[model samples]
Target chain A: MPQLKAKSLEMRTPQVTKTAVLVIGGAEDKVHGREILRTFFGRAGASNGYITIIPSASREPAIIGGRYTRIFEEMGAKKVEILDIRERDQCESAETKASLEACSGVFLTGGDQLRLCGVLADTPAMEIIRQRVRAGQLTLAGTSAGAAVMGHHMIAGGGSGETPKRSLVDMATGLGFIPEVIVDQHFHNRNRMGRLISAIAAHPDRLGIGIDEDTCAMFERDGWLQAMGKGSVTIVDPTEVTHTNEPHVGASEPLTVHNLRLHILSHGDRFHLYQRTVLPAVHRISS
Target chain B: MPQLKAKSLEMRTPQVTKTAVLVIGGAEDKVHGREILRTFFGRAGASNGYITIIPSASREPAIIGGRYTRIFEEMGAKKVEILDIRERDQCESAETKASLEACSGVFLTGGDQLRLCGVLADTPAMEIIRQRVRAGQLTLAGTSAGAAVMGHHMIAGGGSGETPKRSLVDMATGLGFIPEVIVDQHFHNRNRMGRLISAIAAHPDRLGIGIDEDTCAMFERDGWLQAMGKGSVTIVDPTEVTHTNEPHVGASEPLTVHNLRLHILSHGDRFHLYQRTVLPAVHRISS
Candidate 1:
């Protein structure tokens, strides 16, 4: 059923996504500037924000949940709740749905992506969160594995430090938070270019966005993506791919792809996802 | 179209797979013993065998193709032809079709699984190969990347040192020579248990077969798989899996799966593919 829904979503003519999603690569600055987290806190209405932290993905849910709760509380958020979901059935509880409905912002913590999806996929709590985000009634942010689950075609796991080969990247169904794109977190630091390229080679229709550690690729409702934090976001656009030896080569062998468009964006740079173009950064006036 | 075909193949009630397929892990003892290759040669009718070596997966197609051709010829094969397919269009040619139709056995060499697929997938030559294979007219044996591409759900590449996380395995569409199982070559030698397990977690319906170096998982028309060579064939059966936190965890986090039945088969051991049971090896009286 999700596959059918995804197909229909893909078939629909391009429209600006109403949801604002902040996708952070792994190891985001928690102690330093906290520019990314601070940006997310402000976007969620700051003091008026009612935040929900979903730490099911982490092995130490309480610790991870408490960590983020304190961070948001220190930032002066109005209210924050830790949704400790241990089992799939817990997601259907009325209390869980209610918490999601009342929240202005939701944060997904880092852990195993498969575990996160195992508990939340197809659950009513996740459904409500998705509906609210789509309606532009909520702001959502996720880090590390949280960021990896935002696409339809997820790069679940794969090898790095190798040539881009069909065997280098592992893919699984994703949460479809941003269906038009495929994302990889902790990109450059892990030397994950080969895997990402391998992923894009398999799915040329989707835009490949690789977020480096400590970086965030923030998606706005207006369809422009803004880069924030210290690192950069690398985009691999395969629209012009004339030929690819992806299917021709064997595992561990190098892949050959022609004419892939690449773009690297740092803080303040913006990219239009649908248009597949980088927009010139305009000077902002501080009020 | 291939997806539809694959789905239809999957939907069919499990019947005894008539095609005899030899799936070898990488680095099978090519120089000595050569038990695996010799078995394939014998299955193809030994001295009367008309063989076609497909080295399209290798970068040096000519050299790899010649190596197999000589090996087969030295074993007293009736004839051997190296099908040097460099382009997709070549698969549609009459010469290509004729050569495939004429061969009693087909040997796909190792290089890059993606490259092998790019040239052969959905092509007329490949279709003939499949038709013959299904009709039990041809014996097919592939090693390394060749072995990887025999299944419908192919493990293209992935990381090994890490735990079995959803992010550790990369999968792609394979040639479907044996769609019922997913194969990974050079298994324990490369510490690929994690990737293979991750692959099975994603596709619970398919049996996960990990062939070790110098090993082979031979599928007979009778539907029983016999292990050959020095190393063992590890089978990860997910049919009894009651629970998995694969979808619940985030990327890089260890996955939790319960009730997986595992069997490691060595030389002469046989396993029933569909029934999900190990068959006792019968003593053979030498002629």
Candidate 2:
């Protein structure tokens, strides 16, 4: 019966629009960071929302999917399910497409950012997510490596705690969930500042956001970023920077820059992403 | 006799190597930024230096060339001549090619940055400058637009006084004298922080350098950038930046970033380009 319905919908384009992106830094304790999850659940319409957990970023997708399945069910999501597929080809199957088309929320588990982007970027599954997000039918959420892959320019790998220099970080294409910013997860715990700096300096026009190990930066449809969890979110603004030596120095040379403005926002801090303003926590999108 | 000899050397491969680039910010005032030019002259063997003035970046190349010719002569150069051609084709001329071959130093006058790169970026004259500089035979000095085109990425145009936003500035390829930095001139006087930031955000890996109206940032072959002039040189180092919104935001959206390390160096300040350290003013390369 479900197969017959899935085939019928093949002729119909999926109408899905996303409302927000819940990007969690790595090490988000599912227990302590449950409110962040609950916020997604609540925004997803409490017990009535249709949720699909994508654990493809993990090596053990089945195990991770089951874990989230129990968590969401326990959290009062009545129609919770998991998409248990490893191959990119499964996204094209009528069953998977049909299931995803009805989903009101999608959660991605953390593992390898590249793995996630490799499977989903430019794929049918990815297109549905984008279409749904643009149509405002779903809220997307991801953690750790999942979060890292949200931006178009993903930070693949780099060293930490060193001085900013040339070729210190590796960058690659990411799943275009959050298109304007470069997102780095597990930033504080991994001491990834040096690499993050390299990423931003390499493309200073993009906003760089480093989410701490336990934090989440929830980007709403209206372009507001609200912080959640115990850790901080570091914002690197190179817009007002006076100079950078990255383009002048040698490949292995140390880089010098002048006048880069910075901002560090903690949980409860609210930022207007479109207007680029720092609003008080309580002043944010309160229902 | 010197002209004939120069013409002969034109056919010979100009074995030129430059050891350093003396890039001056615009409105040099000859008096305030005179020490920078004096440093170049002194480093090029003072009165014994063979100098060629290329005023191709200027609209009035002949007048600009004549002015620098007299300045270099008055400054006690042994030989100072001009390559007064405006078209790119003239770079193939025997006289122009030979004159540049015998030059131990080249002084590029300021006018239009695009003009400078347009005429010199891939021209034979440019190749000679790079070859000579690489071989340590010539020291090139450029002011204003001449200075702006020293980097691999040039700040073509942008707005001022606004917070950093997407597409706020335009960038083009530069003269490639220095391959790692983005140079912006008349920084403080013209209030160019916004455009500089946009340029840096666009290419974060390339260090952004905004030279003040009277400042000079001398990039030595030893990987040290020494600051010179009345005003400060702003360096926007994105290596340590934690986040940037440039990749996530829309065309009209404002950009926000976090933790971009900045260094504002004034006269006498010396920074190690490879190590990215601020050295004591007195602790510099004492020739």
* Per-residue lDDT over B192-275 for candidate 1, one digit per residue giving the tens place of the 0 to 100 score: 766787899888899999887787888887788887776667777788665555576576654544445655565666778887
Fnat per model, in the order shown: 0.00, 0.24
Best DockQ among the predictions, by candidate number: 2
Which regions in candidate 1 have their CA more than 4 angstroms from the true location? A1-287, B1-19, B284-287
User: What DockQ, on C-alphas, does every prediction get?
Assistant: 0.01, 0.10
lDDT of 1 by residue, A1-287 (tens): 99999999888965432347899988888887788888788777688888999998899999999999999999999999999999999998989989999988999999988888888888899899888888898889989989998998988899764435677788988888888889999876665755787798889899988887788899987788887766667777788666565565576654445445655565666789888767533553110
lDDT tens readout by residue for model 2, A1-287: 99989888975854333367889887666775376777777666567778899988899998888888888898888698888667889889887888788888889899888888877888788889888876778888889988998888999887642345556678999987878889988765565655676678777787788887667898888888887765667676567655566666564544555555556565566677656666534443321
Say which docking band candidate 1 falls in. Answer: incorrect
- Candidate 2 RMSD computed on C-alpha atoms after optimal superposition onto the true structure: 18.3
Model 2 error, position B34 (Å): 2.1
Alpha-carbon shift of residue A251 in model 2 (angstroms): 38
Candidate 1 docking DockQ = 0.01
What is candidate 2's TM-score against the reference? 0.51
The candidates score, on chain A by TM-score, as follows 0.90, 0.89
**Residue-by-residue lDDT tens digits, candidate 2, B1-287:** 99999888886874333347888887666644366777777766677788888887888988778877776787899998888667889988889889888878888888888887887879898898888887777888889988988888998777653445556688899988788899988775566755676677778888888787666888888888888765666777777656666676565444554555667675566767667666535544332
